[model samples]
Target: MEADKVKEACAVVAMRCKQDVAQYIYYALRALQHRGQEASGIAVYSGGLKVKKGVGLVSDVMGPEDMDKLSGKVGIGHNYYSIKVSRPENIQPQSLKTGIGDIAIAHNGIIVNSQLIIAQLKKEGKLFLLESEEEAFIMRLTDTIRATDDIAKSIKTVCKELIGSYAFALLVNDRVFAIRDPYGIRPLCLGKLPDGKGFIAASESVALDVLGAEFIRDVMPGEAVEITEDGFKSINIGASINRAHCFFEWVYFARADSVIDGMSVYEARKRIGWRLAKEAPAIADVVMPIPDSGRAHAYGYALGSGIKMNEGLMKNRYIHRTFIMPTQDAREISVREKMNPVRAVVEGKRVVIVDDSIVRGTTMKKIVKMLRDAGATEVHVRIGSPPLISPCYLGIDMTNRDQFIADHRSIDDIRKEIGSDSLAYITIEGLVEALNFEKENLCLGCVTGEYPVNIPGERRRFQQTLEGFT
Candidate 1:
């Protein structure tokens, strides 16, 4: 499943009261839903942070009818995508007890070297129950912070001792704070309200824009921002060498209009498509994109190949969830609803289909069959990404090794399975180059399996990663 900007924790905290704070939080979460769709939760702290979470979209998690009931002047929300933990129960805004008091924490991103931290805690007789390391983080921090009265200071100290990727928010007592890991593997941003009585913390600036809040600068890597009565203040936890950003976030996962680190995702994708055309030129009557993810790359491919890019297929915007679902049948159904070949454009023409990545062959097979049904003379499949051969330990939904198209079959086999006349993926080096990103700065674990951290012995901890929305 594609993880979007929704995973970063969202919150609206104010010492003073606002009657429409819950509505405001709902709008904020809706904008951030692109980050995670699997599970969603909201914890509101008017006096006590009451939490409600379920598996699905924000509308489903907190339905339109239910929004009024969830209204609060102070609140935090979480949208979950199962990157490391597939079970919906692990989806967050998790409430837990510590030695000092009880705290509610919601997090986006991964904790690298999580297994080591878990093991160390276990050796010291700490009980472990949560599947995600994010939950483990709550327990670890709770225990550590019990030694201090200042929650922000405790978070800074505890985060300094940990390793891995993260953009997180915590509701301890009446205040809220957001933190970004040193490596900045994921994105988190802050927003300001019109009256300055409330603030929001989210994965993308798009969320803030949706909430009608002014965009503040991003929560800097290795930094923490506190949302309190004073409005907001920052704390620096220091930085490290591993500032590796996930290139795919811009390539396919992120919304095209969203920007990261002052770079436009849509433009970057067009750049990749343009680079693809230069590197892998193919003769085709028209260039076809694999519906949603491939559009940007297809545009790029068109610009570079000097070939006309046409809408060879139309997609149903209301396609069912295909990313995290467990069955191939569901995915097949989604492909049916999501895309259909345009015979008028493709008939008797040599078609070049461009896509962002190939996770499994099932969806592509049906798509190719659709094109054939539309009377395409020749279909050449070109992928914009390198072959994925390993599982991602970071916060992505692709946790199963067996489900990957690249892991299970050779190129020829995949081509045969998809029923394409020819199939070519962007080489690993080419993909890295196309992204125009530094290899040393990327967690290419999925493409190369050279994970920056160690894997846990609990192998089945994450499987059927495509389940819910985000």
Candidate 2:
């Protein structure tokens, strides 16, 4: 039932600097604010680990007074998007006192085998304070540290037991540890600060860019990096036999400016748009994007199809993204407030609307209706990514099979459901080609119904299974 609790897809950033790391992390979190908006926090090591977390946006949770108190040269920050109601206890940099030292962790991605691990730990007489996967992770790591007596070895042992995606930033005493899952299903990168002041590891390169840090490279899959004021070192936790990087990162989750796994996200999206145009060209007068995330994709489509690109829908700057809302009702209601049609651009025009992807189709349906109401002669939809037929067990919120509009539905059927003149999604092969990665290297779980990681009751591309963990 991991799918039933789809409460993840967060951002994590860690910094080890000579100056106060908290303020830099604040700016980094602001850059990564798009990743998660429900909650934000930062844990710094002053005399010890000092944590400030709350259930609100980064700016709302941490003001000048809040940042003034966080005095440290090394720290970690998190931006969380919870599919469940926001609670203070669930906000992370989830910390614990281990046998090694004071440990605090901020993680991005979902743990599919967490329930099994939690059950096993319960039988061992370990008590949990909260119903959260971060608590479970802390408990498991605590046990592993107790047995191994080494931080690096402990992380390796925990990685073997974990059967899902994760990109973690851990503060153990004064040093920081950055770890990525074996499949690299989530994005994590390393960066060097100006004047060789410090090192950083974040969920995206954009986080580093905001702080004027130099992007070094992505953390290798199954690699654990230990960073201190002196420097940093990388340790191979496990060999990534079948590296399955999440494809959705480039499609929608990550900021368009980010370069994930060495591929420019903006370039990949634009290429996907070009490919989509080639695969499903529309005879529309003006091509318009859904705004924000869709701008790059729509631009590529316009380039490929030799059509002019226009902004038909203007996004409200204050509205939170509807896709990450906790409930369907909230998502549906937010869509109305999130966008408004430009009557001059869309009216009496044959419009081709380009978007990154469609999950439940409610947003797209509302958008199509909004365009028609604005006097659009016709609204055709062109998705930059392939149709989602399966739930994402790695990190995305589309966990239920029934939540996908393309699930067991044809293209024409989806067109009718969304009330669009036409609908087409990029092909899987086209998407892979556009990303410039081998099809085997990308995690197309939601698109192909086959995951790279071992999820219970799910089809895995590899032979790995979660039976042993259970």
Candidate 3:
């Protein structure tokens, strides 16, 4: 429940239209600001490709004057969040000039085989300009296939060599290319503008909504799409594998209004709450949410439990996501500054607090104490997702096993630690059922510890060393 519960990966948006699309991409990235806040960039192609990028929020990086400089009809945008220190080179829409053309790419997930690809490229006498794994991997792959005239063939070769999760958008001169990982570990969707003159691809449906585009459908797992003046053409460039869409998208990462892989995130979360109410019913006077992420789940819980939903907490709109803050103390302070209990609603009430998940339990304990200080007689906590017991290797920030409260503690121990009168979590089975998708299609890696992709032993050890757990 701490502010650093789970960090999100990057976001990608690409537009191919008759008119200039730099502004469209700018607005779409703003809609997806929740996905990443560390850095933002955009690449547009008119007569030639132009890109503007910096280390900050979208508004901070791109002012009116900045947007005026990037003029193009086809463009790609990226929003990045790094577990490591953010730097200017790490900022993406990473571009390279090759014999074929200038290539710009924006990526949204981790490439597990990046080291292997980098080494191979090195053996081939190639040099990498960017330090980020995505930039290195993409640039090397582009270099490998620079001789090919067909962009689709180049992308297919790249997809064949890479392993792990990713969804990327590429800008090649006047064309745009989009590809989702074989397992669809990340979300990507295609849409059309109101006049049907342009095509949009983004990390979430909500981005398309902001552009007044009609959602066409999700790009199938392992599929590659190329948008040009001719039309949108797609090919299955990846191997046929079981879909392992990141389940956390519905649980925590996505905007409530977004839909991923045919599942409505808001609807999925509401179902999670509905199922939680049935499975872990807590006796209380009122049902309340933690605000924001907990809102939809709390509404579903209230409906299922036949309890009135009340606004027991008010959030400060000015406060940014605490997880992005620099230090633990800063994040803790953010929690206090972000929300305050409504004494009139919680005073002398047996309140049932519905939340999405509890990671470290640091913020949850503080929240319970805050409610108690404001006169709540009882605080019953219900988490929509099952206990997180393992680290996520596919771009989520929960890579350190020691940071998980559930990793070493029992459910009862967590409840006592958080000072909740009672605590319950939805079962893994219940969560999968609520999603209403094939059970195998969901990656419950954090909950189940069974990763869909094979994690190389060396990489695992390296990650442990980085976390100081070795």
Candidate 4:
């Protein structure tokens, strides 16, 4: 019952500027805080790398006194959402001294083959200070740096050893390096601060918008960029033969106000709703959203169906996102406190409820019962994205096959489970069309169960393997 739709890995932000950038990084982290809330950390290089991290919200972890001490013109920050929150050392913007120089790294996606690399390192008598994927990343990078004696070459070598999605922002002394995986399964972008004083690279363009920075462009897939106060430089190692940009970003993970990879997240979501309206129009008296998550999609659904849309649920803004809550009990309690049904609007009305997607069916089940209790005559559910039938290995938190309601259930079964009068979801082709992406260029792995990269024991969309660099 702990299925809160979907959750992403974390957010990474790095900056190099003429003036102290610790404050700016803090603000940017606030803007991207929705991406993670488990832990917050910042690493800055002021003659030396200084790091302050703790398990909590950004506001709880980094106070004014803390920021005053993190004096540096170049720094990186991370907002982490970890399933294993007991390990405080696993929190990131993980900094360590390397043979080349002091380096701090922040990561935004999963490294599927990290265990293999870690095993190889341990076999070679290498020891680790932390037990996490980012730890494995830094160890491997330092090992390669010891051989190549070149930061750029070491980064390229490390990229080859990784077998899954990653968007890394590395702080090397006073420089910042931004790197994206070959498939670009996650989003990362470059931006410029006003007056040419600095440059920023972050997981989303919304970070740039908060800092009044100009978005340069998306960091290309398989590219590594070097940034300093003066400017930035980039080198493309090898773009993937097939692009697998995660379509879920538009559906759920990203802020609706943000734009990613040339597509507006809000627009894509609305378009998905439009598609859903045409494919699964409900014969209802009114259309209403499940609250903020479904608002944009509901707008498009209303527009397409020519049905009046009304706010039938009032969200409790103070409630933390139920999906990111640590435990099943916490998630269930959160669902109870997160939203309330508007009895006046739904009373005696057949309500068509729009939502992004349904994962566990527990949350939806509770919501449907609430609506019924509040006098909604009929509760029909329309989903913007296709049913999630597989777990995401790239960066999302749906790791177990049994957690998905659609993994083994049909539409009618799900409808019965959620106590909905009817249920329908957007088709995969409709999702691609709404996102305005060619099917081959998008990662529909969670829905289709065919990933772009070669994951052992799972189906791959292509024959490409993570080889050559090893």
Which candidate wins on lDDT?
4
lDDT per residue (tens digit) for residues 319-368 in model 3: 66435579877765777798899999999999999999988888899899
What is the Å distance of residue 281 in model 2 from its true position? 0.9
Per-residue lDDT of model 1, residues 1-470, tens digit only: 22211132222222112454566666777776777667788776655556778888878878666666665566667777664325656767887655665577777766767777888888888787774576677777787677776677778778866765677777775667788887577777777777765677777777777767787777777788887554568988765554567666777766787777666788888877887777778878999887778899899899999899999888877655546577876656666666777789999999999888888767777878888888998889888777777766667766677878778678999899889988887776776776666776666767776654345643321232222101
Candidate 2 residue-pair clash tally = 0
lDDT for each residue of candidate 4 in 23-99, tens digit (9 for 90 to 100): 99999999999888899999999889999999998999999998899999999999998786568888888888877
Of the two candidates 1 and 4, the one with more favorable lDDT, higher being better, is 4
Instruction: Indicate which candidate wins on TM-score.
Output: 4
**For residues 142-162, what per-residue lDDT tens digits would candidate 2 score against the true structure?**
777788778788888888878
Off by over 4 Å in 3: 321-334, 458-470
Give the winner by lDDT: 1 or 3: 3
Worst 10 residues of 1 by lDDT: 461-470
Clash-forming residue pairs, model 3: 1-359
Question: lDDT of each model, Cα atoms only?
Answer: 0.71, 0.85, 0.84, 0.87
| Shift of residue 331 alpha carbon in model 2, Å | 11
Q: What TM-score does each of the candidates earn?
A: 0.84, 0.92, 0.93, 0.95
Candidate 1: global Cα-lDDT? 0.71
Cα deviation at 18, candidate 2, in Å, is: 0.9
